[model samples]
Target: MKRFEDKRVLVTGGTRGVGAAIADAFAAEGAAVAVNGRSQQSVDRFLATRWGDFHGIPGAVGPRDACRAVVDAAVAALGGLDVLVANAGVFDELPFEQVTQEDFDRSMTVNLGGVFFCAQAALPALEESKGSIVATASDAGLISYAGAPAYSAAKGGVVSLVRSLAIGFAEVPVRVNCVCPGNVDTDMIREAGEASDDPAAYRAAAASRAPMRRMATPEEVAAAVLYLASDAAGFTTGVALPVDGGGVAGFD
Candidate 1:
């Protein structure tokens, strides 16, 4: 049978990019997936074109009520939640000194806070199902980025928080882990790179900085998450899997 056959999966911010890739991967594995995004219209459009028994739930994961609502919607649609991929986050490129309190709050709310709330609300069902949770962290959480301090710090919190959950829930049979991806060719990274004074040069420099000599694709990172969510990673928990192409090898 397929690995995720009959599994019910929910992927936040799955309207595009990495989240979308993950949602698709699970569905391809025979999962009943719920795709979440801030835009109901986008969610509708996505569901209309996608195969498998997929549901579209629209809401921002940052808000506490919204977080609970997404879980509820997923359970309502798929009967129960077996896996949750917390892929909703914001990324902005600005100097540390230029980052306002508003910027910091927004970053934390979506990146770190959303993960915490979603996992917390999903814990009971997860415990019942012995399910898995995968949070989307960034290589920035393991290293440092010059222009994205807030983003880095928020992602770092994600890694730490999920690790704690892993240990706390060890006996509960709910596995919690994280995926720290490097520069992926998503619109987020592309826009950040292009925001520099020399957009073209910035993209080239960023691309060359990685040891692999190029950024990763969303599909590549999604595969790692899928593995963790499936029985393939049954023994894995509380670990931050780096899809960075050795970007953090020298940093630590």
Candidate 2:
């Protein structure tokens, strides 16, 4: 049988980017996947283009109620929750002094709170199913960088919370972990490069920054997520796995 054969999975912010890749990986492994996008329209668009069919659980999950609702909908749609991939997060690149209240709140609400409340709400089902949670953290969480203080802090919270949650859920044996990805060649990065005054130079800089001299693919990150969620990682929990190309290890 496939690794996740007959398992039920839910991926938040699975409409595009890394989230979409993770959802696809689970579905390919024979898991029933419920994908959550910020809205029904985005979810419809994602499903329309994707070759693999997935259950759509659309909602903007940041607030406590919103997170609960999204999880509840996923459980209702998939009949149960075996793996919850908390991939919904907002990223911003701005000067710290210019950061506004709305920006900070939005970052915390989506990146940290989304994971917290979603996991809290999914605990009962996951405990019963002996399931797991794999979140999408970032290099910002592991190490410091300029231009995105708020996002980094929120993701840092995610990293710390994953460890704590893993310890707390040890008795239930419901694993909790996260992936800290470095520079990824996603649409968001492409857009940033395109918007820059020198797109090629910007892309080149991003590539050269990583020790491996190239940005990671969303699928690569998804692969790590799959590993953590699979039985292969049965002994793993509370790990902040770095999927980055040695970015977290050293600057080099």
TM-score for each model: 0.97, 0.97
- Over the stretch 58-115, how does candidate 2's per-residue lDDT look in tens digits? 9998899999999999999888999999999887777899999999999999999999
Superposed by TM-score, candidate 1 places the C-alpha of residue 223 at a distance from the truth, in angstroms, of 0.6
Residue runs of model 2 more than 4 Å from their true location after superposition: 51-53
Backbone Cα, N, C clashes tallied per candidate: 0, 0
Tell me the tens digit of each residue's lDDT in model 1 across 1-252: 888998999999998999999999999889999999988998998888887788999999987888999889888888998999999999987799999999999999999989999998888888889999999999989896888999999999999998999999988789999999988888887787677788788777777777887888999999999988989788899999999888988742
Quickly count the clashes in candidate 1: 0
Could you tell me which 10 consecutive residues in candidate 1 have the lowest summed lDDT?
243-252
The C-alpha stretches of model 1 lying farther than 4 A from their native spots are none
How big is the RMSD of model 1? 1.4
